[model samples]
Target: MADEVKLHGLAGSPFVCRVKIALKVKDIKYDFVVEDLINKSADLVKYNPVYKKVPVLVHNGNPISESLVIVEYIDDVWKGVSILPHDAYEKARVRFWAKVVDDKCLPALFKAIGSHAQEQAVAEAHEQLQFLENELKVKGSKFFGGDSINLVDISATFIAYWVGAAEEALRITLVTKDKFPKLKEWSDNYINCQAVKDVLPPREVLVGFFKSRFGKA
Candidate 1:
């Protein structure tokens, strides 16, 4: 591997987790660099100068930023397991949902868990959850990709793990079984999948982090 691959990430970041899961799914061997997000490392700043964010994929010293971009880049470069579908329409569909995950789901979930306007945030998040539940029902897929985890599923990693920890830390519930059964089932399946399970941050650690960041510990 002359072009050695390395990932700069923060362990507790769901965005970083997306890259980790993508790498695991593709079975790409890469070095992991843990970046202190609160006090970012020099390499992280240099590599992702635009964002100065975690989950920068450095391939042969070339850097790629943004989780979705990095995940797609990993898929494009590696040939282990395909995350995006082959057909043009199908790939577009996956990309559509992946954007929704970033634009809608991630933002709302973050707001719901940690925003000053808790009531409004929860309401918006609940609406988004209902939309997601309906999307799963319409697609009728076991996972977002039908048979296995894919790019969209990977994009929604926060809902699968971090959201629960956030809820626990804040003493509030959002994705309860009764309210969003289908979404709940999908989350359960997603987190338990081999690639995802192996890389998931510990729940306790996540809870502590969330509490310190947003809640009364």
Candidate 2:
């Protein structure tokens, strides 16, 4: 029998989008179970008891939680397209950058959008984004993964896609071309990629969601 793969996720979630993009890149066929996060499905809780989150990847009978973890698990199990680098150093570098995106960039972005002290939070987000801008300049590639999308690019999906929606909804731009030229270019390249474009949530949907969630600023 073919391997059974199921992704429990919420619509318009960047984390879930990462897994979808990886699956598309590898041509892996799977079922997507859209979960209503507020209601908290039993299967989602059962699959990921600790976090009880959306974006749980259940393969055959086993389950994998966390977006990045599930993405790495997909890369490890699949063949054909490679989501991570072959060299040990390069692989480590990619992992390091991915961590920065999650640990540094993501939190800063959330603060910029949601915090009461908007000015300070936005400044912090810009500081974090500068790191990515410099990394892109140094790499001198269309993506962090050189010619193709990889774990780093997938991990930074939120910055490329969701940020735009957040900016639109909030009427405050955090990643402008003037402040982050290379990152702006990279975002253009990323969202336009066939694989990524195919899997991304609609911009309007995301914008509306953000507007409803955070309210207009």
Candidate 1: deviation at residue 77, Å?
Answer: 0.6
Give the worst 10-residue stretch by lDDT in candidate 2.
111-120
- For residues 1-217, could you state the per-residue lDDT of candidate 2 as single tens digits? 9999999998889999999999999999999898998899989888888988879999998999999898899999998889999999999999999999999999999998876338889899999989999999999999999999999999999999998898888788788899999999999999999999999989999999888989855
Residue 66, candidate 2: Cα error in Å is 0.8
Whole-model lDDT per candidate: 0.88, 0.92
Alpha-carbon lDDT of model 2 = 0.92
What does candidate 1's lDDT look like per residue over 47-148, in tens digits? Answer: 888989888999997999999999999999988789998999999999999998888887898888778337888889888778778889998988988989
Show where candidate 1 strays beyond 4 Å: none
TM-score of candidate 1 versus the correct structure, residues matched by position = 0.95
TM-score top scorer: 2
* TM-score of each model, in listed order: 0.95, 0.97
Candidate 1 lDDT (Cα, 0 to 1) = 0.88
**What is the C-alpha RMSD, rounded to one decimal, of candidate 1?**
1.5
Error of 2 at 75 (Å): 0.7
